[model samples]
Target: MTNVLVLGANGKIAKLATAQLLANPDNHLTLFLRNSKRLANAASDRVKVVEGDAASEADLKAVMADADIVYANLAGSIEAEAKAVVAAMDASGLKRLIWISTLGIYDEVPGNFGKWNHQMLDGGYLETYGAAAKTIEDSDLDYTIIRPAWLSNNDEVAYETTQKGEAFKGTEVSRKSIAALVAKLVADPSQAIHESLGVNKPNTDGDKPAWY
Candidate 1:
């Protein structure tokens, strides 16, 4: 049985990924979040809910015990949270990690698409996101940093990936697609170790996110 630790468990993508993981009875899950009350119903025979801040090493270390893999779905000051996660993982000797970042963090989008993204976010978002990516890259852990394009609630799993340094393609992807990818990686943690990927739906290319 694979023991999965999910940080930011209340996040939309994390919640979907949790359901995907739970579909397989062999997978056991431990959920960590700042407010467990939001998902009080998630507790089950194979699931444990722990409420705490991801930036707290004590909180993370307490739940990191016996975990086989770590999947973090976080936002806001990701740089600081990334640092905390890396420290906790190192302390527990856990190497596998899947972190969710956002597209354009590395200026991977080309031409007008890239320009619009920067203009829309006004730089600060990219600064924090990029810092978080840098932290994971510099760490000793085996990690896959996922940079997803503008997300949609389309309920579909059609998507493609671009390796780091490649121009990010398309402008939107469904949340379900992101969750599917996370579930796949958690099941086989070595698939994309030490790589950063940009995920988006095929044929959805646009100057900006479709919803905008």
Candidate 2:
């Protein structure tokens, strides 16, 4: 079985992804988190949890050892943490990385929408995300980056996917949908290798679908 290490394990999206991963039989997943308290119910006989900051080399090394794939579904100072993760991955000889990024990484949305999103995240944050993405893109290992449109709390999964360089159409998309997509990426690595895209419901009406 392929062993997977999911960084940012305590987050909401990570929780959904973790549940999906647990349901699968061919893989074993380890949840690496900074705080285990927030992840109380996110456990099972097949699921393992490791506590540590993703930015620390020692913690990363402990978790990265024997890990076949890394899923980086994180928030907060993710850029710096991503750098640390890359370093640790390199040290451990682990290659595959799947990062959940935000929309507008390529300035796909324009005018107030893009401006608002960028402004809210700050220019420095934008640069950081970009730099982090570029780092993985330029690295020798295989990588997949997924950027979802305005995340929602809906409990549904939709097969909406957008091509790179296209504007993110939907006004909102479910966080669970994004998490489900992340789970899919973890299961099948070859679908969108070395590319980033936006996800949203397919309906013309701007509404986020609930994740089932």
TM per candidate comes to 0.98, 0.88
Q: List runs of model 1 lying over 4 Å from the truth.
A: none
Q: For residues 93-138, what per-residue lDDT tens digits would candidate 1 score against the true structure?
A: 9999999999988878997888998998755888898999999999
For model 1, which pairs clash? none
Per-candidate local distance difference test: 0.92, 0.78
Error of 2 at 53 (Å): 0.8
* Best by the TM-score measure: 1
> Candidate 1: worst 10 consecutive residues by lDDT?
120-129
